[model samples]
Target: GAGVSQSPRYKVAKRGQDVALRCDPISGHVSLFWYQQALGQGPEFLTYFQNEAQLDKSGLPSDRFFAERPEGSVSTLKIQRTQQEDSAVYLCASSPRTGRKGYGYTFGSGTRLTVV
Candidate 1:
């Protein structure tokens, strides 16, 4: 794909259900990031992967939230035990540089998860 692609632009999950969001970044992007965006707010960093290695996951809200990029290209964000509070947009971003300092990133449209 020419840009980042995310699956299931919209998802509706029942309470306690588990959901997996997929992200396919642009080819050759070394840095991948997952973020959570509450309604009317900016995206909050959730995790970061550098070439298949999870370099930073400190931003993950809880153990139920997991993200991985096995091949450094495609990434997945899995939410176990969905809750009403988990209803938000999950965003995926990719950057060409690993440093990530002042660098621009390409972001996906995001997966909007609604929990009921």
Candidate 2:
């Protein structure tokens, strides 16, 4: 894929269920990011991986949330013990890690996770 790809475009999870959301960044992209977007709100950075090295994870809500980019090209965000408060859209984005502005990353359509 030429851009970020996310699976399970929409997921409905019952309370206490665990779910894994997948993301495949553009080939050769060194920077991969995971974000959480609450309804009507902008995406909030969840974690970032720079070629398999997780550079930041401070946005993870709790220990129950985890994200990894084992290959640097693909990533996954997993949520445990799903709660209603966890309902939101999970987004993935990829960049060149150039730290330069104007080169916006490519973002996936996002996975809409709904917990009930």
Each prediction's whole-model lDDT (CA): 0.93, 0.92
Clashing pairs in 2: none
lDDT of 1 by residue, 1-116 (tens): 79999998999999999999999999998999999999999999999998999999999999999998887789999999999999999999999895637678899999999999
Model 2 poorest 10 in a row by lDDT? 96-105
lDDT, residue 16, model 2: 100
Q: Going through the candidates in order, what is the number of backbone clashes in each?
A: 0, 0
lDDT of model number 2: 0.92
Q: In angstroms, what RMSD does candidate 1 have relative to the true structure? A: 1.4
For all predicted structures, in order, the TM-scores are 0.95, 0.95
Which residue runs does candidate 2 get wrong by more than 4 Å?
A: 99-102
